[model samples]
Target chain A: MAEWVEACAAEDIDEEDVVRFDHAGRTYAIYRSPDDEFFVTDGLCTHEKVHLADGLVMDDIIECPKHNGRFNYKTGEAKGAPVCVNLKTYPARVEDGRVMVELD
Target chain B: MNETLPGMVIIGAGECGARAAFALREEGYAGPVTLIGAERHLPYERPPLSKDALAAEAPGIRTIAEADRFEAADIRLMLSCEVAAIDRAARAVRLGDGTALPYSRLLLATGARPRRLPPAEGSKHCLYLRTHDDAGEIARRLRPDARILIIGGGFIGLELAAAARLRGSAVTVLETQSRLLARAVPANIAEIVQAEHERQGVRVLLNAGILELGERGGAAVFRIDQPGNDAGSGPTEIEADTVIVGIGAVPNVELAEAAGLAVDNGICVDACLRTADRAIFAAGDCCSFPLEIYGGRRVRLEAWRNAQEQGALAARNMLETDEAHASVPWFWSDQYGLTLQIAGLPDEGAAVVRRDLGEGAFILFHLAADGRLVAASGIGPGNAVARDIRLAEMLIARRAAPAADKLAAAETKLKSLLAA
Candidate 1:
């Protein structure tokens, strides 16, 4: 079953940036797209388990800080070499100035 | 002569050669691809050998891709195989097993081997790390009661020291130069690294000259002279259970040289990573190619990212895509809780502007005489400076001339400057 959980304030993360959130002993990354839309995915890089929050976000893509592994955060698709495993994405929305992610 | 069709042949199976093999398939070259490796294991990542591989409870090889991935890609892997000579006239490489493999195009990614200390050769107490098996041997000696002595204060030596300290081993580092990472990083960054190592209970001796190295009572013993010591005091002797030599690496260019390819500090290649023979090319630590972004200055980088990028580039050029290598030079090292990242060549800078990111985290932006951004170096705990350093790399690639005031101000977004 999926449950909606409050992650952070909608304004906490800058536009075109990502922030890390921990809940129920699981790590997650919340992204605010350049258009102000919210998205969420597993926090660690699939390649090296590196924190995705430290990575740079350009549009919908996130580049790993350690090895430059790239992934499309919006669709959970790995972009290229050094990273073949795709990230797991979650349903995200903003309500009452709070970002909510559906976590199972 | 071999009966098999000669599609694409790669001479080495390290990160560079392995990546090139796959990259060829990705570029829609639906032809036969063969990757030959001297090692028995599959192609693995080397960066972890000095850090994570040493610190792990049960260290194992971190391969670039699994064996099944290779099978699915239809890439032929020839492991534990050595190419005896490159028969250029016949366009075939003769293997040590007396087999000849021909190729339409060839890539030499033989990489490099550790420079062995003359005195420590064949000594069981002295070890050098260049492969997975080497890391396993070093890990066995990193117990709590063990004493570790590291020679050379370069990235490999410093990282090993950090790993040893984490495992509760007593570690000491010796550097012939006045500072650590003298050739790779600036003095300011080197000081931070040295301090971090000291904080972790690692002894660092700079300007320490090695007098002799020998085994006594099954322990590695070293006699060293400290620069500030009295003349009559003589040399000080240090003993350790294990002595690791991380002096440096020499490119494996003998094969290329013997095949009549130009060899400078490394195998000489053009901007497109191709040798004088259009059918043959070289990449990774084995090849020294001109940097187009730096006005055709030739440099040989032994970095992970460089190897991957160059491998893919070589694959493209091998298929006659004719793409010049234009990426800026980038490197990173992690020790204790601090991470140091450098983008572009710092030596090219005529001046520097410092940017503070709070909590002892900062970045130094290097500018040329004409105020063009040349490099950016940052050191901080975790990934405090990763984003900015990445942005700085882009600016340097664009040859941007952002104002120093804007660069020094932490409030100014480096991404915004990219749009400008």
Candidate 2:
């Protein structure tokens, strides 16, 4: 059985912005798109493997911060130089107001 | 674009080859594109082989293209096939399996191999990290307590030293020059790296040249000599469980030259990357073309970015875009988490200016003649102030156009320098 972990307070994230949360020995980046939709991906840059939590989030894309490689926040597909690996995206759900992640 | 006449057959499906292919497609040429590789893996960045591959836990490896998606773009990838010979006269190529494929054009992206030691090589302790396999094997051998001796202190030698020390290895960098990265970078910049390496407890011995390579007690030994010191100084020997040679690379121009192309330090290609024959082109580590910054001298560049960019441009030219590939050469190496970026070319006597020389320390070397920004190098990329910085040296035969005009003039020179 997997756990429905409380990741972060939904109100903590500003619109079209991102916030990172730690839970159950795991770290996840929570983002709110310009359209108010929410998504999360593995918090790491595909190039140089830097943590994506520290990367730049721009225009529905998470720039790896290092080498400037990017990935779609929605699909996790890699875009740009230096990184070719598609980012591993994590699915998320929102409660009445708090953001939650299902961890297996 | 009518599949542009004389389709190109590029060998060695790596950064150079893939760039050429993508450039061709992006230029709207529905031509026949054949990308051949001796390795089965899709074209992956190779610079990391000596650095990141050794530190898999650390990241920054980005593949310039989609791995599986290359085929979707109709790139004829002949992977895992050895290129036997290039039949230039017939305008075709032969694989190791004896398959003759004709082409109206050819690109010898047949990248170079690591310059190895003697065939009957003595010790198994010696190493080189030019390929992924080489890096993987070296990575496994890297131990904190291991005594690692790097034969050359060029970028690879110094980079490996940094990585090995990070893993707690007793690292010693042996460079024949009095300063590190002497030929590649200016003496002062080399001194900075040397000081930093020494600060990190890396034993950097400059002007201490290696006489020969041999083994004693399962360890590699480098017979040492310091020039102009004395004759009876006797050869001092240093032993290491592991030794990596970075003496430099020998261009893989045999095939291109044997095919009747003008060969220099690399395959002699023009500004258009066209070889002696218009139908053939060359780029990357195996080719050397004229560099305006180096006083129109032809020199070889083995930088990662140059390989990829040149590959793309070669492909574009092989198609219909007849644009000259004159991008200012830029290269960077990452080690100890410090990003070292160099733009343009610097030769002996080129003036240097230290920008922010602290944690954000980046010194820009301005190689100017009659006050024009002939070459600009720093921890970052080029600066449009090249003409000003370069022009400052004008009185000493280094002055040129005014610095103010280089940028504020609202001219295209700024745009072109920025592109490089």
Candidate 3:
């Protein structure tokens, strides 16, 4: 695994906005919830692998606009029909006054 | 019938009917309520008929009884009386016998029946499954070594094949389409399922046609017409000791139609599951209402969850409050040790998203043109999709927006929950 990269500064997105960042040639959806919470997970719905970056993000939950399936952004757990898998989550941290994730 | 809304009366003691009764009580209606059932059993769960009852999947998958149970819930259960007619003018329902029950509100939860195969000249040994009693009979007559020929690769047919294989029977599934489960899943997605079932020793015949289902030497032999090549495109034949037909279902609509209610492929209903006649409400398989998912398209769903949830929602709206029917359609099927689940409703023109697949587990999501959730199917991942669908449905109620991040966390936890 590669060393963790400071992919994006914490201020890069709105609280409810989900932005895509790349590290180690992999894509991730870095979510900054409306409550100023920071979370990172594989940027896709686990069930159909639809990129979560393109899904509907609510409070702490994101719904795959594709099938309206949902997942908890914090734990990356998928909720809804046509989905029963979990989003791969990367441990998220707020360090150096910025959102930092150990993405290898 | 003229003055005040008649007391609510629900026909059929299935899960929908029972839930309607409970929901009415929950709705705080002080008027008289009655439940008429054709089956003698209390509103027992019917999903087991296709799964546990046939494969012995669970020790006691009996019908659920809440704390109020039947007695405590004050549900007037009328067992073994099939409603034969609905006198809409008089605001009364006529039973098979000479009894007529007058009601101010009537819920037609008269479910569906299996579609029979085309008739042949001679007698053919065929079987179909729907009710608990149907499952019981099939279970009793199931022979471990019997070879089974099943028509229709739909959920019910595939489920029965899975059960039959589990019970030590040789199973062969035939589908007229190029892929199995064509109606439920995208073609490419269905390929994965077909492959899985095949890996488990199921004989899957696709792009094959059946001239007829007839009896030959006491066995059901399906005459096949293959489509790919000259050699395979001729009239071929397959034989089995037992034949199971699952070509889909026809909604039981005689009573609803005869009652002068709006009837299409199923009983027509508005946002509140109300038929043309305001006095009647229909739920479960017998009715089709405007579904928000298919872009306000009217569709009929026969899955057990759709039956139960919609039935309850309709009940709650009809008796208790003036709430609209907002039940999101959901369904699950177990086949070849794989559990498939769905959330939302799907039609012909949706896009398919292939999520994940490992060791015969994965998911297929159906998305609409604008990417609004239309339908999804979880294989080995059904539980998550099922739950997310439910949660999304609630969000739809609030007409609120969803945070993509929260859904990701929920998705992460779902895998563990499903395994547990």
Candidate 4:
């Protein structure tokens, strides 16, 4: 079963920032890139399970708050060292005035 | 097509060498790539050795390029092969087995070796952790209730201490210096790290000298001398199951030095990462390159990021395009669930502005005399300060001078200041 839930209001996350979204019991990091693009990935870093929501979002890359390892927010590809695994990115979209993420 | 391409031989199969090999192919280079490593295993990551490897959590190759990646890229890896000398005149390196591999361009990423304590001051049980094998040996002996005596309070020692504590082992760290990480970090930051270790049940003894190491009653013992402590009026004895020496590393510059290459702390390279001979280039811990950002001061960084960047740049420069390498040097250390990261070189006597994010989260921004951001360190929970460091790195690279008040304000977003 697939579900699309409203994570937050579109304006809730400022540009180049991230917000933590909890759907049911799962956590995801909803990011807003500098170009006003929306992305969502697993909330924690693949390196040490640190929250990616608290990390820095630059362009389309999210620099992990722990170890400064990086991940491409859109595709969830790891960008640098100390991080090997790709992040699990979620399908995100902005509908009307709300940011929604698809969970299956 | 492969035979027509130029031959590129990289000397070390560590992180830097592996990245260089992949980067070469990624950068549109159609070349016969040969990667030679002295270690028997394929190229693996070294940073996790002191962390997970020491704790016996995971005991396998933490690889940068898996065997399949190298195969797909057609990068030939020669393992367990020792290069005896660099025959510059012949444009080749002669291996110990008398195999001479010729190269049009060569990259020396020989890395470094751990500085060992003299035999007289070290016992049979004394061990040093640098390679995967060393980490495995230490992990095997890190049994519960094992008393682990770690010498030196540097990153390796502290990381070992954290792993030992997690394994239910008693860890005692001995530092000859007055404070922990005295050489790497500022005194104020060192205090916090020392406190964190102590809080986590690691006994950190600063300003203690090791007189000798010996075996007694099936356990290793260290005789120490403390300058002012009454407990060490003469010599104090500390016993442990094993003595792990995490002193420091000496750059592996023997081949470069013997080859008559410019050698200081490491193989000297220009800003473009090319050695005295244009055909030969060096990077990683083995090479000292000019830091244009710091006024051409030669620096050899052992950090993973530096090695990866330098190795790629050296390869690029060898490809006929000389792009000046410029990026703020960055490094991060993980100990006791705390992430300590620093970006840029902290200038001497630089003014520091501190911001407390509350709940033991803090970020320190270092500014030079001219008011440009020189460096930034973040010691927050789960590396909440990494963003601050990234912005600081940008500011330093641009030589931007923002108002001091904006830097210290809690509500100010680091990236917003860049708009000006």
C-alpha TM-score for every candidate: 0.98, 0.74, 0.72, 0.94
Q: Pick the candidate with the highest TM-score.
A: 1
> lDDT of each structure?
0.93, 0.70, 0.71, 0.84
Q: Using lDDT as the measure, name the better of candidate 1 and candidate 3.
A: 1
Per-residue alpha-carbon lDDT of model 3 for B326-349, expressed as tens digits?
666766676765566666654532
Q: Compared with the true structure, what per-residue lDDT tens digits does model 2 show for residues B175-266?
A: 77767887677676677677778888888777786677778887887778787445646347788889887878888887777677788789
Model 1 chain B worst lDDT run, 10 consecutive residues: B226-235
lDDT of 3 at B281: 89
Residues B1-420 of candidate 1: C-alpha lDDT, one tens digit per residue: 233888899999999999999999999998889999999999999999999999965688899999999998889999999999998898999999999999999999999999988878887899999999999999989999999999999999999999999999999998888899999888998999999999999999888898888778989889888875466354388899999999999999999999999999899999999999999999999999998878999999999999999999999999989899999999999898999999999999999999999989999999999999999999999989999999999999999999999999999999999999
Question: Which consecutive 10 residues in model 4 chain A have the weakest lDDT in total?
Answer: A59-68
Interface RMSD, candidates in the order listed: 0.8, 10.8, 10.1, 2.6
Q: Pick the candidate with the highest lDDT.
A: 1
Give the TM-score of chain A, superposed on the true chain A, for all candidates in the order listed: 0.98, 0.86, 0.85, 0.95
The better-scoring model by lDDT among 3 and 4 is 4
lDDT of 4 by residue, B1-420 (tens): 364344999999988888888888878888799999999988988988888777674466577767897999899899999999999999888999997888899999999988888843546788898889888888887888789999989999999999899888898999998899887777777888889989989888888988877778999878888885665554487898888998999999999889999998999998988998999999999999888777788888888888888888887887888898898888888888787888887753269888776678677888888887778877866656677777777887887877888888868977888777
Poorest 10 consecutive residues by lDDT, candidate 4 chain B:
B228-237
Q: Give DockQ for candidates 1 onward, in order.
A: 0.87, 0.07, 0.03, 0.55
Residue B159, model 4: lDDT of: 92
